[model samples]
Target: MSPATSLTRNQKLAALAFVLGVALVYYASHPLLLCRQLIIRDDEALYARLHLGNDLPYAWLTESDYSFRLAEALLQGKLGLTEPPPEWVNETIPLRGRYYSVFPLGSVLTMLPFALAHRLIAFSPSGAAIALIGALATFLFLRFALRCGRNFRDAVWLTLFSTLGTWLWTNTAMGGAWQLALGFAMTGELAA
Candidate 1:
């Protein structure tokens, strides 16, 4: 009932909607976001070839930074947040190659950690594990959207817009098809 609260109530929700819309642009691209930390440590060709080759022991080690290689070799099966690189490489973010040139480079990076995962978990559950991660991300997104406003109908519409918007769909087509799906799901919630 205070003057400030009244003023806030008077403001159009359009601003909130616009912010959510712009946020949807970024959210539609979440899968690409998670991979940035890893990508910062390695080049495009090295990681792509490693992934395409199925994360072979020697190949992964050679493509990965020294610390990442050492840790992956030692603990190939653990599941948790990875440690940052102990050292830096110049021009670490490569801009060349098919995946990088086309997609935003996030999908590749997001897949990077899983390369070493083969050494740890049973191969049978890997697909399931990745799916679980995607589902969890989607859940988090829904929670965030609910917190943004009380209008359930409005939130649902926004969710659809953010999840299936052009930015995400186009980017997904460019590269990282799987990541695009997961990322759009997570971001859609936030955008809603």
Candidate 2:
């Protein structure tokens, strides 16, 4: 392949790497220290809630906090792979009902593997991993957008702007991984 073709392949691989790394890091850095009930923050709470009660595997899955719930679901089986519930109801997985109807369903679908992996290891760990992954996706999406414009110089300028002046940086700093990913995805989509 020519240099241009090789460069394109690398960029594609970078995108894949970014997505996978986000999922893995989220899994590894997950707060293994905290208990499910003690997690009070809205986002964290949502994940904690999913695996609660008789719901067990699907405890945290809910409609109100769809994206985070979806993230949690994605991390279910990778680590230890939680034992299958005596009965599995697809609906119990949380975030499946209303979310699957309106949105593109891409994000929700992308989340399943990680959720399964984390569910296997432990619920909280999976949640933390998913959150980190979402944040990483947001950051990388922004970086990709900046780099794809004009040339390297223009890419640098855009990156600086996104880092300093945009919500991209703020969302990540605030630990709003979903927001980061949403903003990046929306901005890119709109731009396109």
Candidate 3:
């Protein structure tokens, strides 16, 4: 192939990669997937409340274990905490007489933008944000595949397989607190 033609082809391939990555992420992050509450005992609900300016340190005490805490925290007033609940009794970090999530803050930090957007728009945006993260993770995996001397086609296949054909898909789509944390950790390692 001519030099100019090869360059143009490469550019096209790069664009295709980006577009496909974005489209797949969008598809996976739909609210339909999020509304099902596949995993309830997750940090996403807590983070969402925190981003919306609700008191996080004490909210968990009254929130039901089976109910959608994010929706309740957003719409309802905080219930009076007469006593620490069973869930909170064991998992709290006491700081300055306030309790906090035992989970790390990384996942919450990652979802901050989405939480803010959701707060503003009155809709959950976690799915989209998680999808974007997953897409970026796929791109990083693609780069890693290329650096390992994979052909363009093979690298693309590897990226798809790694992101979609593994637990990565479940974590990204579900966007549960622990799942997202695991996804972010794995993606961070891959990107690094």
Candidate 4:
């Protein structure tokens, strides 16, 4: 890689900082957190520092848990749910004795690692995973923007606009089934 094309040390640090900022903003954009609800009791100690109350798991926010089942099925080498999903899975369809998610496989595949983690150690990974995808997608955008322009600061502003000024803000923050897929699609587009 040519020196002119590659990021300098300060530019790399700035890009990483931008990614971290994106992650923090997206995670805090959750509706419950935004409202400053007393329901975010978390192990991270962040809520304590912020002086917020509430458990981390929000029911509406977890409507996308069905996505994990699809990811898990893929891990097991199946395109369809071999075992029936829980009764609460609303957006699934039963076809020819097989059940599948209404969301496409691509979206489900994006969350594959989170599903694998949940299956392996029974740790809840969806919340962390969504923020991670959001960060990764933003990081990709920063790289692309910097490549197209010579100024890293200008790239940061453009990237911020793309993220904050678009529907991505709501969709990625909501963390719903469709939203999760959209985040993956955006990341895939940025990657391309």
Q: Pick the candidate with the highest lDDT.
A: 4
Candidates' C-alpha lDDT: 0.38, 0.43, 0.55, 0.71
Off by over 4 Å in 4: 1-6, 32-63, 76-88, 95-98, 120-123
TM-score of each: 0.30, 0.35, 0.57, 0.73
What digit string (tens of lDDT, one per residue) describes model 3 on residues 133-188?
67777668767776777666787788788877887776556555555667778878
lDDT of 3 at 131: 69
lDDT of 2: 0.43
Q: Which stretches of candidate 2 lie above 4 Å from their native place?
A: 1-66, 70-107, 120-154, 172-181, 187-192
Off by over 4 Å in 1: 1-112, 120-137, 173-192
How should the candidates be ordered by TM-score, best one leading?
4, 3, 2, 1
When 1 and 2 are scored with lDDT, the better candidate is 2
Scored against the true structure, residue 17 in model 4 reaches a CA lDDT of 81
Best by TM-score: 4
Tens digits of lDDT, candidate 1, 50-166: 465643333222322222233333344433223432232221223332111222334334454554565576331223223433334334443345566535445545545643454
Please give me the total number of clashing residue pairs in predicted model 3. Answer: 1
How many Å off is the CA of 157 in candidate 2? 3.0
lDDT-sorted candidate list, best first = 4, 3, 2, 1
Candidate with more favorable, higher TM-score: 1 or 3: 3
